[model samples]
Target: MRYPANHVLGAQRNGVNHVSMNMGTVPPGGPVRGTNYPVYPDKLLDWYDSAGAGPMGMTSVRVMFTWEAVQAAANGPVPAPGANYANYWTDLVGVVTRCLARGMVVVLAPWQYNPASKNTDITYQGQPIQPAMFADFWAKLATAVNAATGNDQRVAFDLINEPHTDEESSLPGDIGISLDGWFTCAQAAITAIRSAGNANTVLVPGMTWTSAKAFTTNGSAAKWAALTDPLRNLGVTVHCYSGIDSPGSASPTVLPDACSALVQWARAAGAKVHVGEIAIDAGDNGFPPFGGTLALAQAQWANWQQFCLANDDVVIGWNWWGNSAAGWWNAGDSKHPQGHHWGLSLDDGATRTVYADLIAGSVRTPRLVLHDNLADPGTGENTTTSVAWESPDIWVRQWADGGVVAEPVQGGRSCTVYVRVTNRGTATWPATGTDVVTLHWAKASAGLSWPQPWGGADPALGGRIAADVPIPAPVAPGASTVLAIPWASPPNPLHYPDQDGHFCLLAAVTKAGQPWYDGFTGTNLNTNILRMSHVASRNIHVVPPGQNRFGSLVVENPHREPWRVALAFEPLDPWQQPLPSVQGRLVLRPPEHVLHRLRGMDNLTEAGPGRVALVEPGRGLQGLVLEPGERLAVPLEWEGEAAPALRAVAYDTETGPGTPTGGQTFVLGEVEGWTVEERAALV
Candidate 1:
């Protein structure tokens, strides 16, 4: 099927904006799907039957073979024609014949990079091969393969893997070949192959590890394009790996700009485009930096497939770097022995991962998360004890200015609630009104119960501050959008003198067919917030410095049985710590003032001054109990100082408290004495 040049590949649903990918005229046949074969040909049938024949539905295979397998020596005294030569050549031919019989396109790639030799020259048995010798190897290999497969169009020859020069090497001590020298060998190989009367497709790769970005920018495009191909079936191949430029990044965001540039180069040069090697490490199983989540890694894989599908006109196909055999999965075809595992399956190919399903055309559902902190992965469960209430995802701003500032919710004044929703899934969430965010408010409490404490399902109960606020735009995969809901005249604590002026805010996102919970019954609030990404709460209060703020909160036992509870105070990090002057730079609070204390808890035995201080940061009060269906109103009196301060008051049911079930953060605003420049100098 052919698409028009201006055809739109993205569509919006229910007023949400979806990013459009401009598609040019699509090639006659859709792009072929494929994976790389192992260095040895023993597991060819096993891989072809599992991934290629089954749900993965791969239509091509890039067979990896070493130059030493075909030739015994570098220059002279090479093996005779059609000689097996250590049984490697015979095994490789059998592998190619089996692939062709299964109606699969076979791409032959030579694992020819020499690390010990200077200039990354093509080598045989750890010795650099001359340009003429390199050409002779391809000529003989092409002739033999053509004779075996009868010059089948389904067979293609990739010149070499990741040709690079000394200037292009990102590593030390290993000098690479000159670009001109590498091109001379490539041109010679092409000429020799055509002169041998083998008319199969020829695939040429660029320098700097054959990276797509380097192909266009590193002079590989013009040189490779200039090489003569009598059959006019030359294809340009490039490799793309996530975080290829930024080393050690677990889940770097992948974009289509490089792929688009590659397609443009191929179209302009009149060469077919193919991704010879491409794969991403699935960092889902407790991998460092990804935090054992599939959201980020899967999103990257989806982006890669989308790029290939959107540009099928110029891009002929892409071959994944591996199958799941243990030795080949991470070995990287003898080039880098310690390469990472980029396979789509695990457990010796018994377990098919998310990438396998994605290759079979499965679309992952949208996973929406409202992060509790910067370090919170969407799946982290109640792991943060003191900072649960200080979420970066939810904030309160002035209604008129829409300025995001650290301030309390002023009673009887207009304010806007800003909630950031991130989509971790591959599929975009439609802007349809069904995808809604609701904001609720309740009196600040240690243990908050749903319906009873949060004003039951009825709007008449007056718990909901904002209901059914639709996200203005569609959130694409790996994208975040902030929704603003204007709250006019929020509930005033002054009018209801019996209630404390402090309130807790809860924000939840609900969409049809997504996992959601209406209440936290069996589990604690923190655990629920951690497990469910769609919900988050804020119980932070901003108080002016140099003044005493009085408030009270209820400490209740939400469980059916009596429970012992412990409370403590902890200092916030420098970034989240409030400044003395909102305009001034932040400086670390003095160690003495780090314990921002709250007095007037007369019921607890350890309520006096200095006794109630946090015992060196995370340690707090212990050995207090509340019976089932009991609630205690604890009064708090805090005298604010002139210095900038921010602290969290956390309560937990465990003895040696870890991962607090509920908490409240207090932020102090600017004082009268400090100047902005003085604070800056101190910092």
Candidate 2:
């Protein structure tokens, strides 16, 4: 049963307008995901006081405490609430309470997964754990933390955000557990808090969403609905996904369908929703060719956010995911993050005016504009492009329980439909982004929303390519820009080079100051192509006999990116009967002077993904994450002596094991310094 469509939540839900993200870590360094303190407690509060609570506006804040830290030295007993854990929280809880004084809500997120089970896990020292214990343990932690943060309405528990679909989960732990599991788990803590007479509304997920839509479509919706009850005014949170939308591939929408089902279900059930996660990867990537010029997919995401604002009245609250530098989650303004320039605006005070406009009122936003890259348009070359914009004022982003602010006002010309142009861009500067908007584009809607394939369901959701689509010129910041887009033939796009049956053009936006919303859409999408650069390079050489009864060989990738390097060595001379050097540790050094020893079959512990790393590169080194435009050097040497006719094989992670971009195998064929023999036949 769904909650009443117009059910009203009290002041706790409506009055306070603040969002939070689990940033940084415990010791607070690596990833800002779980509990990284993005800034020192004092520094954080200071910034909140000064900067106005990040790009989403509102001055409220929240963070999680490491239960592991509290329970660290537990030996004789699990310790009492007034002991080690209690002391630290006494101070921690005070900080959150202060946010309330400043007109903010202190949302407490306690102990996410202990990472006990799973192929990839967050561990306790070196041991793995069983998941069943997660429930009871969390219950105890909540009990303790509730006391610290005040259960009498000062704080609310986010309650184990996205237990599934995080990086720690198998593929993406973004799916829903049954209502029973949800209830049982939540019941343990809810019952405890209520017993203590605490009124903090607990948070949970509906059917559970993927880091986008990776889960909703995973076939668990019916199962999810099978387990609902009446009195749980519980908040079901979710993370949606618009696959590949991060890269600006327009189409493949996942928003509408998921939101409709969630809203309708909530309306029927009488519960409230809180979107603890939502974001658009704000970057200048491609968009579908509607009129003359294509735009960035990020723009499309912004427009959808406008729709979200319109529906803010329905859900209780929302939280943009994150960004940060010293940490990695919430976009921060420090100087550490490498893979982190994902923030909506540069952390150096260069506010992204477009994105910053979202930081206001702390209410769900409405659509002020609409732009759809229209990724992977209908399988034909003919598509009509139209744009709609609302200059007056609009807003949206990560509505609660997968909902969207879908009310599109006919702002008229403000809603310009760029049907044909070879160019398009931002005003006052080439704001390299696109704002593609579509309501039920997800083959879903509250009335009759979309599922995975919206294009296959609704005709209005798609269009024919407009003639003379524009191609944007190189961007120059702070300058009014205009570019055209031309819609050429064979509409839509496929990820691979040339494949039949086109996918829809789709796009999503990850609010800069946040993490990519666990988002999704209901349609397949096609992305545009950038100028494909085809130039490439490689290097190979044979090493002659060397000291210590061995020889050496080296190979290199002179061009950018770690390339697919190949190496091969068969006996070049028929007279050399190369006896296989049983000791595979024989090594050869490359320009980097790293020695590469032949692997004795026993040395490799083969597993799924790839062979175990015997020479795993350190975190900040160019070991595994090979960079572009750089050469890699490795050395080779053997343990035993051999004839001058043994052949060697060379290959790398890039071009595969046999073929590099050079067209010619980097080291294919026989070597002149040793007897070339089959690896399988070696003694």
Candidate 3:
């Protein structure tokens, strides 16, 4: 059905309300009764100002108007014009006006209900009113509210309140309306509302007290499916409360799968739905007021909140039942015997209940965290080896910003950066959406500003470029996944001479191409940025030789482009013999059968134990090329004197014979292989 055109919280509107009494008051310290204390005019305005529009921050209020409060005589027919049947309707109109003034939507739910004195005989003009009369009442009421509020779109109407097959036992149990009859009344009311020139939305409820179960089980679907609102503004109002009848039932209905399925069905039907009332039971639901724990209440509340958020597309919002000290808020307090401890705030009026902050905090925002180290989800630890099986002695720092600088950039080359990410917020990460990890070319150490290095650089990168790797899995709170981000260094490095031939590579987890909402603010970005230069790193470590004196040579490439370095050694002992000659192989392999190559590399390999040779990666039979962030290790052994001293050379293939990195010398200790004395000591 056609609903109000301008409402927030995605058409359904999140809201709460005062009880089902248009005008009345229960004693401040009174006994527990069904009737809501009639709200005085001043108190009505106070409630709207304090709870409705103030701390509670709800978007709408359902004003419960009774037939008795409108008609002068219970047995009288329609009152004549200018007759003294009802007062100016000042209290009712005033509440609606104030709510609208505060930008709160209003629903007029007039029931043939009058329980102030516990009387349930619903009659007018000395005769029992028929089911059709309920529709007539809504027509007149909608007309009155339309004129009173200038036909505002924020106002809506409900034909009847909680109509069922049998009258509640606590009341008079005089008027029993079946589900079919209720549907007829609803349709009649919608027609009458339109006839009165009031175009406000209509809230149609199902049998069984208008609950999700009612809509799903008790023939509600049949009735709803048959009824049609010509205006197309009809909506379903469902009430949800855990364990309402049984005070100590073992199993309480919390987040029922039926409720979720119902919303999906409503969405398919293009209908709006509102959770008109929801609360946790004191005894059956294991909540307070019946010696239960607050944890139970929190769980119940959280489940409902998550359900609403998850289905926000079709479900409008919800409203807690009552907000007064003399109502549901009572929790057996002597000062307010009628309270139920379900109030979002305390009865003292100003004191906020434990739920005040919780209600506000229920609204969620996205939070993303980019880990500094290569997180191993399998082991829950940072890997000492390079990602993609590249290096080990690279010494990349974990849990610290600016991990070890990666290989430097060659003028123009494609690079792959691996970073682990986690969602640390309350919301779930959508598998594929506007949220993604982006690469940027940042300035030296100042990572704040991201100026486009060139035109067509950023906007060109779109649609799951990084998800190709095994890192696109959706993550929940406290869960992590990896991202293999790619970036191609500027092809013409000479064009930016002022850039000092060095810059930083930054990877950001962004939402809609911007810093995510509710994420770390101000310079504390959830991203991975590492400073890199056009240089390579090499190291030689001496080991206690087993078969003979031996040492290892390690080379680390820190640039986006691939590199090859030739290795040679200076003997520590003049009589030491050379070790075996070993051939080196390329590091990163291209995708099988893929014609394109990423980060092209040069050629170099060890000629002999102490010699150097040259070859091209992907071209020669035996040659070594280091991919960006790749590390290579080579071991050498020799029969030498008591102690052997040696110097290793690791020169870039492009640097001819010159030692770009200072060749360092390392001394190796004597080989102490399994000897008789050592074996005996071990034993």
Candidate 4:
């Protein structure tokens, strides 16, 4: 949903119940779809509501508050509705009222903890909160909330957020606390709320950050099951990040079964369950430093949401951990720090993430995704040879080669282009044979545009349509299948004998009614390849060592106006760096120079061993000016020596500054052989 720009909790700078300008009628529904809102209130109500069209389509909210904000002193009176802001009472009431008016089911939760106290008790101000004080606080809160909203059944009380022992430690379940200790305080709060004549649902969490898996593993299930509620309207709350109880980087292989344990426990305990907090990083499945793909994050959310929907008998709802600001600031703590990535929207709260559609459950159609780099799915321009093959999903096989290979497009020879597609959605793709996979080829270039660079109905663009293959079998959700298209003759590399003879293959999957592309307009190949899942491009080629290879990169200005463009080559380790066994250097020359020449030229500068930049004589490392639609062929000559493999990415940056506008990664090496077993092992 939407959040304020700053981290303010509620209205009123001091102690006064002020009138909230924003108010509306509450909406009604079931099976809560909600997100966590910041502590305070602000004018950004539409941030989440969006005038009834929720950004996240959220029906409820889990509001956060601190124990200190609720109770100023131990065993002291909890301020009433009109009470001053000494305890944030007025602000709390105002927030709850506003949320209800906007038709959002508000779940009030206390973020109370004092790890330094070194005890299992809920602490306030670094001291243990007495049971009597805890009960008194809940009793007062219940009365205030009841009176404030006429006992709105839509309101809920989440006992506490992620309760655990060893308050000072960041790890959840580090040193286990006695379940009985936590239960005593929880039961007291429940009793207090019920005794206050408030029937709003109460949610109790187990020890160890309320992780679903830990709920039963940590012996919390049995104790929590014993908790008694007079209203019999209680539920269990749990938190999950990357399929675990603790917040950290997401595991690509880890199937999200966060609710499995809780489902079993809930069935046995006969208690409803609510996932209070859940989030996956948008970047590389929400983990940093270790490269990953958006597909990983998409899978996590899809599977989790599916599980929750499937087990609606007990699991009632879930809340995304939070906004971008909180997520980024916490990164320093090394918890779930990539809040921007985890947030539904990017930092701006306007641009939706790739996983937003999945989170919103707005679309249930099949989403077929073809990975550019299997090792790192979302990375479009990949040169990593650490995994034998970068674009494992796409390969070429010819009887002459005797096996499957990723490079060396044998010109004028009959070959089979195999592309693997995975259905990442919840629906199955029917076997109508209409789900077509078309492969388009374009001249090897640092930047290539759609339709024009690659051919369509127009034969003037080199007529580069390689093959179109359709699937004959139904592709079930989460399942993958390979489509093989027989190419009578691939473009003869002999036609351009002076060029490297490498072509960039673009594969797009289309169904009868499904969108032709997933967020890809095809103008920016470099960026779109990484963002779009339904389309993938492969531009890798292997060259023999000690031989000079010439490749022509067609750099064009896609925009209408003239612009200055720069070309830069970045050295990359086909085998991720620091490998002593694999070593090599890449050498480059201008098109005007002879193939055997080793001398540097005036137009080129050695930025590093294998890295070089095209420069103008008077202007140091300058770009060339290109008019609209001007296609410039920049011939590149390069050779590799003394290494298993050498790779570099040639970037065609339009603006000359900041990030490159587009680029392509080229690799030089022997083709990595593929086997029948490897083909069968494709996921």
Per-residue alpha-carbon lDDT of model 1 for 1-683, expressed as tens digits? Answer: 11111111011100000000101111122111122233333343444433433434345677766565456455433233332343445556777787667545677887654545432334455454468987887888888888777877677788877777656665555445667877888889898888878877788888887888668888888898778877565778788763433443354355365566777777555456777776554443322243323565567666665555444445666776555344434322222334453455543334455545434442223445676665555532435434556566677776646454545667768888878788754456554425678777766667665544555453322377777677765778777887877877577767653455667778877633222354234446665665555678877666655544434545667778887777664444355543333222212111222223233332222335433322233344555677896656554444223333344454555635655667666555552221111112111
TM-score against native, each model: 0.44, 0.40, 0.48, 0.44
lDDT per residue as tens, model 3, 355-468: 454455443322344432222222111232121111111212212333333333344455554455565444455554234555443222111222232112534211122322
On TM-score, the candidate that comes out on top is 3
TM-score of 2: 0.40
- Write one digit per residue (lDDT tens) for candidate 2, span 217-271: 5433443444332434455555544422333234423343335565555545544
Q: Which scores greater on TM-score, model 3 or model 4?
A: 3
User: How accurate locally, in lDDT, is each candidate?
Assistant: 0.56, 0.33, 0.46, 0.53
Best by lDDT, which number? 1
* Model 2 lDDT on a 0 to 1 scale: 0.33
Candidate 4's residue-wise lDDT over 513-594, tens digit each?
2333333443655654554455676665555434445355555576678756665443444432323332233344434322
TM-score of 4: 0.44
Task: Please identify model 3 stretches exceeding 4 Å from their true place.
Answer: 1-5, 8-12, 23-54, 71-88, 114-131, 167-172, 243-258, 282-291, 325-341, 344-348, 354-360, 363-683
Looking at model 4, residue 669 earns an lDDT score of 48
Cα deviation of 52 in candidate 4 (Å)? 6.8
The predicted structure with the larger lDDT, 1 or 2, is: 1
* Least accurate 10 contiguous residues by lDDT in model 1: 13-22
